[model samples]
Target: MGRILMKGNEAIGEAAIRAGCLNYFAYPITPQSEVAEYLSRRMPEVGGVFLQGESEVAVGYMIFGAAGCGARVFTTSSSPGISLMSEALSYISGAECPAVFVNIMRGGPGLGGILPSQADYFQATKGGGHGDYRLLVMAPAGVQEAVEMVMKAFPLAEKYRNPVMILGDGLIGQMMEPVEFPDELKSEPSNNDDWATSGMETRKSSRRNLVKSLFLDSEQLEAHNRVLKAKYDRMRREEVRYEPYNLEADYKALIVSYGTMSRVCRTAVDILKVEGFEVGMVRPQTLFPFPEKAIEEAVRRESCKVAVSIEMSMGQMVEDVERSVRGRCPVEWFGKSGGDVPTPEEVIDAVKSFVKELI
Candidate 1:
């Protein structure tokens, strides 16, 4: 609601409030603990629910409880904790409950180190849990984007009646920067009663509502999947957000990236520019939709020789980049995992090496 210097984690919690999410349920976990800590103090002041559950399992269930009660609820956790919550997250999507989850990603296969990693990109975008489900996974490149991405998450969640995740790295969670928000408080009408577990007779002559993800029959499951498919299709058509940077002149190359990795690409682009290289970047803001069109256009630029995907993981986003580029340009990947992130300088070196090969 005002201009302030805030860590990315704190900004996410604040943006939830700005977006009219009044309930937060989470456990303390590395890299993202500040999110819960911020809301724990701020929620009481605003008369909202802030709960620190015993474990990630309980935290996710707590979110389910709040969502079932027809409240706009949210939660935050790191890689392993998010893994623990995947069961409930799948259930939440199956119930078509509008909710938000933030994953300040960390490296992992099991018990990964506590530093920033985009290793969960696939998990967030491809549905970490079982069965066919998808979430709106937004990757914010910087603190401002993190704040706004979170604010957008609530409305998108309600619009689609599905879970949305703000997927950032621990660098994002710990890093600080300036953020601004609207002053006027405009609240939206709640659509919770149509499916929420509120008491009966409150709406007078309406039947009770049941919120659940259970369906035993194959035909029923088919019908459910069809509904989900249509929703995902609509999102693909309407919400594929991306940003193209330093493009007007033909470019030497296009860098494909997202989140903090995208910011690193930007820095690489700047260094390349100083050296008279014509490189640009196409950064996806909404990871789920994958921003296929902009990436395609970037790959087609006449000066573009290749598109390099730099990620903090073993190239999850690289898969999407290649799909978008569609053989128009050579695509290379440079990445690290297990809690490692490449700095802008390292990214520049990688890009230069890539360019040298093409030359």
Candidate 2:
């Protein structure tokens, strides 16, 4: 297919359709309403369904309804709305239903101002929902990542039978980028009537497929948790995705970051290299299954000593950085929460300070 100049939100909607997600349920929210609006137009053309639910709460349940039927489903929102949907998200994860979610992050604790921020890092990765389940969260730093991850999210969610999230800040959601919709895309499964209650009678099968997350018995719930934990354990080993740069040289320090902040960190590495400091960066693509081993390897590099974790939020990713180091190297943090993004120069300043401290 030809490259299309697309806004991030529109790209996400098209990508979802291309990836075979046919059922979409959403409540419009800033920096991401475009996603829902786009789907409302596109899904109908594909003979798919786009439903505007009564509220965010109902929208989440709508996702549950579609996903429980073994259909490809999706929803999107910003910070506050995501929080409102978290309870249902937990239910979907516990039920082990395949679904996709997009969070165009904005500032937050309450109705925090929406410009661009990664304040929902912990919520997305650490599972803010009230249970021991993790959504596969993909952080897209650029518009291309937005589309690609949205495509990848479908298979990943189905394979895991868990909700997958494409987490982007406002800039990535609102910005434009060249995107190529793959020529080899396939339509979603229609045989979900095999399990879905679409009211097609005269079916011969007596075995009914009931999908529910409710496990009231304590022993059974514990066993269910253990099984999910095993899946997550496997994911930690198999899905630790990251991009490293300037890694071959002798480095006095390394910077760890992700999403938009990682893009700036890359620029900082370039500028620092122009002078004298040997620095590198590790940008995590999958935030839930953190690139811990990658971080460890970079920390163990001969040229590296101190590592700094930078983010658009204050010290959220720093937690992972510290865990990766395991006290072997000094891990530091520099970030601005609440709708602020640091420039390359600011990152360079932080990196230089770390180098100076090491010297």
Candidate 3:
């Protein structure tokens, strides 16, 4: 398909349909409700199912049910809505079900506001629900990236039999950009005769397929957790993705950022370059398998005197940045958590402070 101008939310819905995900369960929430709105009409035309659950909690279980049956299922929600679905996410993860979730974040500790925010970085990269499970998290900087990640998320979920999350801020959802629905990204559903509770008659087998997260035996549960941890470790080694900017130049400060916030930092890098200050940026594409090695490499540059984590939240991702740096150089953070997004000029100023301190 040719590139079409589309809102980020609608593009996500279209990308999922193109990826052969026929089941969608979600409840309306600010900034991301358009995903449900778009799919509600589109799914029926595609011979797919789109159901709006009474609440996000219900939607979470709905996803778990379809996934256990070996169906490609997905949902979209904002902060609080995703919080409601956290328990179900843990359940689905524990049961080893493949599902997709899109979180278009908005500001908040509570009801917050319907504005862009990256405060959920911890909730996403760390663990939101109980237990020791991790979600394979991808952060997109724009609408096209969002569409691409949505399409790719399905196959990745099936690859590990785990849930995947596309983490984007509110701006990514509300903005419009040209995007192409790639034919190559369209995927067929996985053959789940081995694990999925797909009907026995359909598979022409008498063996019963049972799916449940509950493990009464301590050893069994610990064994299951070990298997899950192995998958996460593999992700760290194989799925670490990032884009480096201005690193080719001898930079004095390295900036680590992601999602919509990275775009701002990228602009800051360019402007600083024009002002005769070489700054580097590492934009993480995958949040879970964060580009730790990339950050370490960037900071080791003799020209680089300091590393700064620029984010939408006050200072959440800085912790990970610190771990990656490992005291190779000083690590600092600059951000705002409220609705007011930090402008490119503000980022430039912040980078200038870090760069000038060394000189």
Question: TM-score, each model?
Answer: 0.95, 0.95, 0.98
In model 1, where do residues sit more than 4 Å from their true spots?
Answer: 184-186
Candidate 3, residue 117: how far the Cα is off, in Å = 0.7
lDDT of 1 by residue, 1-359 (tens): 46799999998888888878889988999999999999999999999989889999998888888877778889999999999999999999999888889999888879879988999988998888888899999988888888888777777888898999989999999999999865433357366667778667655537778888888999998998999999999999999998889987578878888888888788888887888887888888899988888889878878889898888998888998899999998999998886767888888888888989989
Which lDDT values do the candidates have, in the order given?
0.87, 0.86, 0.94
Compared with the true structure, what per-residue lDDT tens digits does model 2 show for residues 61-111?
A: 999888886778899999998998899999998988888999999888799
**lDDT: worst 10-residue window of model 1:** 182-191
TM-score of 2: 0.95
Candidate 1: which pairs clash? 252-278
- lDDT against true structure, model 2: 0.86
Task: Between candidates 1 and 3, name the one with more favorable TM-score.
Answer: 3
Best-matching candidate per TM-score:
3
RMSD of each: 1.6, 1.9, 0.9
After superposition, the stretches of candidate 2 with alpha carbons farther than 4 Å from their true spots are: 184-204
**At residue 339, what lDDT does model 2 achieve?**
79
TM-score of candidate 3 to 2 decimals: 0.98
Query: What is the TM-score of candidate 1?
Result: 0.95
